[model samples]
Target: MLDRVITISREFGSGGRELGMKLSEKLEIPFYDKELISLTAQETNMSVTEFLNYYESIPVTEQSLEPPLYTSFSPLYEIPISDQVFLAQSRVIKSLAEKGPCIIVGRCADRVLEDSINLFIYAGIEHRIERIISLNKDLDPQLVENKIRETDRKRKDYYQYYTGCEWGKAQNYHLCLDSGLAGVEGCYQAVLSYLGHCI
Candidate 1:
């Protein structure tokens, strides 16, 4: 049986990927993040760009924009093609879980593998703009703020639309982290400690 499955979810510029990678090394488990999307694209015969365009963004339904009053001619309410692709992604995630313990990052993976011994971690910073600036030296504050906000919004909408749950809620995860507080290695150690205790 698989020992555990770790899902690292994050706000934009939260260093979740870095944390996931380090944790994977410490735990000696495979890590899946962008690879999940790439694998799904290969299985579905869709280009990565095409697959990402629809599912990676905020679903139109969740936005504050006014809904179309009439559906006579519009197919807006119909499921986007990415939903089908996500089904494929979910299958791949399950397959990996069956293979053995692993760490998965951001594809609604926590919800996808909710039945397993799951460890859900979220990383964010109180001063997101400054954190982004520090992490990415060349980017200006305005651009970083806009980019961070847009990416987080997309992730939030995607998780809510796909899993029917609010994104970034503490209840959705086993542990929540602030990179500014824990730093990458500290966050990784926390996850290790929890996994050691639980798994």
Candidate 2:
């Protein structure tokens, strides 16, 4: 009965990566995150950085945005380097899931595997300045907070463009967690328990 797949989408500063890693270890399954990005790069014969840039935002034309037409770009317009990477990565993800159970982090995995169990995590302190300072000892709190905000904006924009869904919206996932509330280890266990029930 080990035919379940788990997809985790998270906000910036959340310990989603850590949670995915821990859960993978506990479940004894392959975990994919940035590694999937790298693998996509390899499969598509594109550089990792190039794939990352195209990963989320494919260019759209002005004509497509017209009020009357409200037309969307042809699927080919989404065929830039990163979009192709996503296709390759998605194929890999499907192959992995079909082969057995696995955990995927980010890369719009929830959307890619819409039928699979999806969990979204958002871990942010009300005061990001403090969280940044705690997470990165070398960086100043103010700078870290600024970085977090900027990074989060990019992630949101990317997700919206690629998945046609708002990032961090609770409705997008089966479970939405706050790492700051659950703590990293607790979140890990929560995911495991969630999978147990899902199976």
Which predicted model would earn the best TM-score? Answer: 1
Q: State every prediction's TM-score relative to the real structure.
A: 0.82, 0.80
Candidate 1 RMSD to the real structure:
5.4
Backbone atom clashes (below 3 Å) for every candidate: 0, 0
- Candidate 2's TM-score: 0.80
Q: Model 2 over residues 1-199: C-alpha lDDT tens digits?
A: 4467778887767777877888788778888887776677777676777666766554555533311111223563454444555567767777677877888888777876757778887766454455556777788766676777887887787677666788888888888887787677777777667767773
Candidate 1 overall lDDT versus native: 0.71
Instruction: Compare the candidates by lDDT and give the number of the best one.
Output: 1
Task: Candidate 2: give its CA RMSD in angstroms.
Answer: 4.1
1-199 per-residue lDDT for model 1 (tens digits) = 2377878888887778888899788778898988887788887677877777755653354542332221122342354455556666777888898888888888888888866443444444346677677777898888777888888887887777677778878877888877767676777788777666774
Question: Which pairs, if any, clash in model 2?
Answer: none
